[model samples]
Target chain A: MIELTDVHKAFGSKRVLRGVNLTIPTGTSMVIIGGSGTGKSVTLKCILGLVTPDRGKITLDGQDVTKGDRDAFLARFGMLFQGAALFDSLSVWQNVAFRLQRGAARRPKAEAREIAIEKLRRVGLTPEVADLFPAELSGGMQKRVGLARAIAADPEIIFFDEPTTGLDPIMAGVINELIREIVTEMGATAMTITHDMTSVRAIADNVAMLHDGQIKWTGPVAEMDDSSDPYLDQFIHGRAEGPIAAVR
Target chain B: MSGATLALAPVAAIGRLAIFAVRGVSHVFRPPYYPREFGQALMQIGWYSLPVVALTALFTGGALALQIYAGGSRFNASSVVPSIVAIGMVRELGPVLGGLMVAARVASSIAAEIGTMKVTEQIDALVTLSTNPMKYLVAPRLLAAVIVVPALVAVGDSIGIWGGYLVGVYHLDFNAVDYLKNTVNYLESWDVVSGLIKGAVFGFIVALAGCYHGMQSGRGAQGVGRATKSAVQAAAVAILATDFLLTALFFTS
Candidate 1:
């Protein structure tokens, strides 16, 4: 389980996260949805230690993550970056096997390549795709490659950042289903952040809405539809006029 | 900016750079060294830079010989060409000019490439994959630059001597045997060794400046552009500063 207790983060004089609290239980999928520029990425980055929170306690599996052994703590978690941030120089298989061939999981190149191919297969990618560069793949295929890479080390926890963004509806559905299957099959705790409701419905066991630098609402996915929170309704239904003002 | 603020920029930048250098050095001894990444950086920083350094050295040596002969002609000391040209190339021009050229080419390239990756979040992806960004991205480049730049300076020195030999024998009507003997007799081990040492320091400066600016880059297109410009400018400035300090230390006695 991952827990954030009243997190606060500021950049210069501008505060981005303000006393935000969130919890994701073991073997469950939680999707945090919000409009653009609501500090969604900042929240995820704080958990990953990309950005240090000004004040908060982040605990992973009951251990204090902020003051814990970083390498060991990171070993148990996997993340899919927002842009499917694949290395252009490395081939797809190499990118997927990156974690499998590092630290405690260190293995021979051939073995790592095999594991990469297997994960790619699980994510609905062919063996030929493994030899291709990231620039050669379409946006959807890149997301699949990112997903394969995320699960390559069989991590106990996974964080997906905008997994379904910039994909067609059909491809988004495919990715969402793949994420759901991988989380369930591996019995891994998963946290995904996106504004896509279809992705929320397909992959989320619980839904949390991040707004005004804090989680405004959270409930079971089944209860997501009937929520009385205006923020939740306006965000889910994609209304322009709402309590959440457009940043632009 | 005020003159006081402008003057403080170098001091502040040096302080930050020192901190970054210390952090990177600490990371090197830590776990998860990526041999593959380092090998690639070696090829790019070291091997690929050779031809350009050689070309620069060749032309510089030739030019130095002609200028030396012309100036010596006024005093009927034209025979001074071979020895003076050889010493100048090895002691000053070879390493310093080669470093500046590489600072222009390699530093800008590295900063632009890495800054783009940073903006695109590829470095973050490496972290998420449980790979250290310092190990995967910076270490190899740093190691390769330090090791390769010295060898490049050595090769450039040899080519530069040959360029001077051609200019002396053909243009100045100097005997080949006498010119070669003068160059051989005037050359000192300390001179060559000092030049190579300077090369290594300059290479480190180039790679370090590139990696530091790249990692510190902000969002969007302008951030990347600034990183590239700063990397080249910093590398060039460091090379010249290090060259002056090394020269004073090496030749003061």
Candidate 2:
């Protein structure tokens, strides 16, 4: 389980996250939905220790994440970034098996490549694609490659940031289904941030709506449509005018 | 901005760069060295830069010989061309010009590549993969620059003196044997050593400036362009400034 309490963060005079408190139970898929620039990424980065909160307590499995061995802490989590974030200099398989190539998780090169190929296959890519660079792949293929890399380590936790942002609707659905299946099969605690309603319906077990740097509404997916919160309703229905202003 | 803020800005920037340099240098001695990356950097910074350094030194040396011959002729001392050319090439021009050439080529390339990586969030991805950017990216380049640059300067110095020899012996109708003898007799071991030391320092400046601006680059294409520009400018300035200081330290009475 991952828990964040009273997390507050600011950049210069602009306040981003203010008193954000949330918890994800073990083996659950929690999708955070929000408009652009609402601190969703910042919140996720804070948990990953990529960004430090001004004042907060983040505990992973009852251990304070900020005060432990970083490598050991990071070993338990995998993240798929918004832009895929694949290293252009490295081949696809090398990117997937990056973790296994160094440090405490170091493995033999051949074994790492084998595992990379397997993960690539799991994400609907062929073994032939492993030798290609990220730039050679199409946008959809790159997302699949990113997904393959995220699950390559079989991490206990996985983060998906805007997973289906730029994909066509069909490709988005395919990615959403893949994400849902991976989360269910691996039983890994998943935290995804996306505004795609289809993705939310397909992948989210629970939905949390973030507005104005705070969680405005959070409930199980089954109850999300029934929630009467005006902000949540306006956001989910894609209305321009609401209590939550369209422009910041 | 106020005058005080303007004055303090450079101080603050220097402080930040100092801190970044210390961090990068500290990682150089730490474990988990990436030999493959270091080898790649060596090739990029040293081997690939040879042609430019060689060409620049050749022209500078040839031009220096002609100018010195012209000036010395006014005093009926045209025989001093080979000796003056050799000393000038070994003592100053070799390291300074070689360093500036590298600053123009290698520094800008480093900044652009790393800045693009940062913009794409690959640096953050490296962190997530349990790799330190300082170790994997910055240290190898720093090591390569510091090690390979002096060798480049030595090559530049030799090529420069050879350029002068060509100009003096063939173009100016001087005896080849006499010109070579003058060059060999006038050049001192300290002159070469001092230039090599300056080469090492200039190399460090180039790599550090590139890596620093890259890591600090903001998002987008414009940010990368700015970073690349700033890195080359900073490196060129730093090399020239350090050259002056090193020259003062080495040659002043």
TM-score for chain B of all predictions: 0.94, 0.98
Residue B14 shift from truth in candidate 2, angstroms: 0.9
Q: What tier of docking accuracy does candidate 1 attain?
A: medium
- Candidate 2 Cα misplacement greater than 4 A, ranges: B1-4
Q: List, for all models, the DockQ compared with the true complex.
A: 0.80, 0.87
For the candidates in turn, chain A alone yields TM-scores of 0.97, 0.99
Q: Give lDDT tens digits, candidate 1, residues A1-248.
A: 88999999989878878888999999999999988878889998888888899998888878887776788878888889878999899899999998877788888989999999999999999999999999999999999999998999999999999999999999999999999999999999999999889999999999999887899999899998899899999988888888888655
- In candidate 1, position B30 carries an lDDT of 71
Residues B150-217 of candidate 1: C-alpha lDDT, one tens digit per residue: 88899999999999999889987889999999999989998899999999999899999999999988
Worst 10 residues of 1 chain A by lDDT: A239-248
What TM-scores do the predictions have? 0.97, 0.98
The backbone clash count of each candidate, in order, is 0, 0
Model 1: residue B87 alpha-carbon error in angstroms: 0.6
